[model samples]
Target: MPRGSALSQSLIDTAHALADAARAETLAHFRNPGLDAANKAAAGFDPVTEGDRAAEAAMRAILAERRPGDGVFGEEYGITRGSSGLTWVLDPIDGTRGFLSGTPTWGVLIAACEGTRPVYGIIDQPFIGERFEGGLGVARYRGPQGEAPLRSRQGVALKDAILFSTFPEIGTAQEAARFREVSARARLTRFGMDCYAYGLLALGHVDLVIEAGLQRYDIAGPIAVIEAAGGIVTDWQGGPADEGGRILAAGSPELHAEALALLSGTAAEGAA
Candidate 1:
């Protein structure tokens, strides 16, 4: 869609509305002592709480009412096909672990996608009263201090960059080794920020976020936001990361190339 077209505005408005509705549902269960979780994983612990369900349901309700022709794909509910060819991809609470731990790093991810590509997206942290938006000619951050343009830090070298990832283990043992190759060279490396790390990348506070074993919802929103902020997000092979596996996000192409070389074991002696 054209950046400032009527459809673009309408979709943007609906995205904010969906975020608002999700905020209420998620906040209601955020730190509730009575809140409990169910394990979605069989081998280890992958938790899903009422907050995830309720928040997604609330957003779906708004989509069904206002954008009935658009499709919906959410973490909790799977997919609901529509004729418009645009899907609203949602991860009601991107970090269930963080939410369960009562940390503010968990966020609600909302993205309007055309096929596999996100055209507009929002990363919202309800507890922090912050929202990062991008795509459709929009790249902005709105929070307690007020709204501001979102711009990724430019010309950062990998050795001087700060990096983030949700888990120290990353994907598999080999993937973890690849991650360590990059982390070993970074000026600073932090873990466990979930989607909020992407928000920080958009705000230029961080330079890179690498992860693996993600779903479409895990990355679509962040991809839109970070790309809008003039950053780059792709798989380790420098391919599309929208479908979600082994993502490498960097604030600048220089950083991206340097990190990509390390991740892929293709770095020259003095590359980047």
Candidate 2:
């Protein structure tokens, strides 16, 4: 089936419910004095906590009951191939660094993909009671203030745009140099927001997010939300971000185009 064809309101509802259940498991470990974290990667800092495993396990159990035929690909536990073409991409705790340090910026990311294309995504920050959902021709935000439609800010210039990256040290030397080229031209640049920055972009608070060294689970949910909110998400070379590496998101197409030029090094520094 094509993207969005297999998706229904029922599936979306189930996605939200999965996030809710995962949130409970994650919260149980969040900030717990006894919570233990270990580095999963040998070279880089890839922290995995008991919370991450427990939360993903919780969601997988729910999926086994709720969507038995659907596949599951998760950050913590890896893939469970299913007969159904639709697959759930999950990151139980997107910002484990923030979660470990007691910051609420970390969120539960859930996305449903038809084959390889994502059709539905939800960024659930349970601690803050905020949920940003997109796909199915509508994007919405829910929080203490209540639910409202989401639309990205339009016609923002690159020089006046707000840029975010999970870290300045992402990717190789060449890639980092390319990122700095764009960051130098932006009006303001902030780092360490992780997936939260993408949610903010969908809400029109942040303008551009450039990051590298990401997995599919990291970008899937954010891409759905940003695109549904009238934004653009693509790789550094202007391609789909489905496989997740060196992704850039802009609140508007114009901003994206301008940034893409710099990221590709096709434009001179400070080019208007």
Candidate 3:
């Protein structure tokens, strides 16, 4: 918005609009047996339902109408021809497996990026009527209870913290092995959370969020929201987690490094 004015409220509006559109379109497919789920990547592989495709298409359409020049790269649909610096990364449905199973853990993820770096993000859980959005300076939470500022939990060590993730099913072979090492080092691990799992981690209910086989859209929204909420997020290799590799986010820098070392097999029992 306004060419790089990330803090400007106008920028926030676009993010919110896209979030609203994607969330509505995604929920429209819930509980509808008639909806089609097709293999989008490899054969018998990652599924893409009408929900995902329509949600992304809806977001793209809104961008076309409101921010005519902004580029959009989505999970279901490919990139649309538009601007580069002003971009929107979207995961129309994060927990598609859960969605297909009639679970409500799925949600719509969106983030605004400038020059390949995120400036703002919004994760909308339409079924639960909740939204996590923020960027420039700070982040805020709005839900059925109304709006409030959110902060990460303070000063927790790995042994005392709770960890959340997608588990081995969502990871590649190499990533899965690395994840086992990390799990052994964590206090505890829980499975079957998509993007919502990361939101819970950022909100301080959980301490660490480690996910693998994630696409750009999968991590972009969570990265912006969590970082804005004062948590640290990065790739598994201890580098920037801009959809570069896998993702690991922790409540603090200490935990972030410790988790990275555990996954990397270089740590000596929380030595990081």
- Give the whole-model CA lDDT for all candidates, comma-separated: 0.95, 0.91, 0.79
Off by over 4 Å in 2: 2-7, 269-272
Candidate 3 lDDT, 195-244, residue by residue in tens: 88777766778888888767888888888888888888888778878763
Relative to the true structure, candidate 1 reaches a TM of 0.97
Ranking by TM-score: 1, 2, 3
lDDT of 2: 0.91
Tell me model 1's lDDT, rounded to 2 decimals: 0.95
Error of 1 at 248 (Å): 0.4
Which is the leading candidate under TM-score? 1
Q: Estimate each model's TM-score.
A: 0.97, 0.96, 0.91
Error of 1 at 243 (Å): 0.6
| Clash pairs (backbone) in predicted model 1 | none
Better of 1 and 2 by lDDT: 1
| Per-residue C-alpha lDDT of model 1 across residues 69-131, encoded as one tens digit per residue | 989999999999998889999999999999999999999999999988999999999999999
Tell me the lDDT of model 3 at 35: 69
Give candidates' CA RMSD values in order. Answer: 1.7, 1.9, 2.5
Candidate 2: tens digits of C-alpha lDDT, residues 150-213: 8888989989999999987979999999999899999999999889899999999999999998
Model 2, poorest ten-residue lDDT window?
1-10
